[model samples]
Target: MSSSPKNAMLAEHRNIPYVAAGVTNPLQEFDLYVPERRNTLDTRPPPLICFVHGGAWRSEDKAEHAGLARRLAAHTNFPVAVSNYRLTTASTPIRHPAHAEDLLAFLHFLLTWSGPHTSTPTPPYDPTRLYLIGHSCSAHMLTSIFLQPLDPASDSASRSPTPSRSPSPPPSPVPTPDSLIPSPALLAATRAVIMSEGIYDIDGLLVTYPAYKTWFIAPTFGRLRSYAPWNTASYRSRPGAEHLNWLILHSKGIPW
Candidate 1:
């Protein structure tokens, strides 16, 4: 007897390392969900849905969101990838750009991945057609990847390195110049971004919700002397930024 639609099976690949295993951090991994095809004759590759989770940028894992990924894959008949990234911790503090860097690495991996399945003859999803969905802080992370620096002068000034009296350990290496800057190919391939309750205006958020400062802002981004560097609302638009479609969702009750 044929299986019921409610009980349909999905092909799930778990803990697939996007970065070089053991060489880099272990959090740079993702879970992929592929729905079983009902039409045998349709051979066209489907678009990829890359989901970025939200947990104040300090909690949650890809494994925790497998159900969402499976549902997305099954509903849309498209492959879905739920990704993990380095999170801020008390013991080993992680800050801005680290989380976004890990995400960019995953994107690079997906763009160049060669389907090397030993058992199945099925091809991989089309990398050129990517639909990104990010929630909460994830919205900030995704924007950090695609948006240009808000102020080139200030950005360069900040990197000039001010003199300090007290000796301190070197700041964790910032992402390379090209790492945060999305390439033309990447921008072209990204079809759309859907941001839900996104934290775009950092300063605005802090002005309204003072509790966020203690909850996640300080922990994830350090003391906020100025929120300009972390704010996505003021980011400059590049050449390719206009081409991609964007959908921003916010609750009517909450001011976003």
Candidate 2:
């Protein structure tokens, strides 16, 4: 759905509160928006799009785009949700991977947002057709955590000195014809996604990006590598995964 439909599905002012990231108190609050409308399909079921804010994973909030969410819901004829995630602070307990892990929790919240699975007694999801949108830091979290693969084998001695969200998974030679294919805990079924101005290159960005170095890629999610190389090639080689219909508004396109 486009912006048009999103603006069509909101109340004069509808607000929903959610915890997009963080594991403890003062985690943060997120707001859901629906534009004020009359005789609009706002009441009807429609697609859903979720947005992640950017602040280099250090800070950001849903209010950053609450208006956009409402306008989007009204114009696109879809429901829009924005979320908050953990960030790096100047105080004690500085855990770097906290942001990435928070996203996973948020994703879980999205998947089971409605229906049988909700943190609350009720589900917040309105429909499928999930589209994720992120800018800058949020994009890094979204892509690195959800899309990009890690090298997995690198470690203390041979590990690439970089500020990676994670390390390469420990060395495990690609599965042979005799081995069983590793299964995915999550499916690559995202309808579409948008990322703006991000350090997509995990290796290059991590080595240079200051924020990542401070975050703990090593202590947290682990130096988890990406899908098997074979899997990436196959997934990309497939019809939709390659096309992805992804919109990368950046200084350049993807490598190769």
Index of the highest-TM-score prediction: 1
Q: Residues 11-56, candidate 1, lDDT per residue (tens digit)?
A: 7776777887466455787877878876779888888999999988
Give the lDDT of residue 4 in candidate 2.
25
Tens-digit per-residue lDDT, 1-256, candidate 2: 0122233435322232235334334344445554443455555444457788877556666666777776677677555777776665555333434565565556555555442223545433443446778787666555544443334354222233333354433422331111221113223445666887754444444445535533633232224343123222122222224434566666554331
lDDT of each: 0.75, 0.48
TM-score of 1: 0.84
TM-score of 2: 0.58
RMSD to true structure for each model, in Å? 4.8, 8.7
Clashing pairs in 1: none
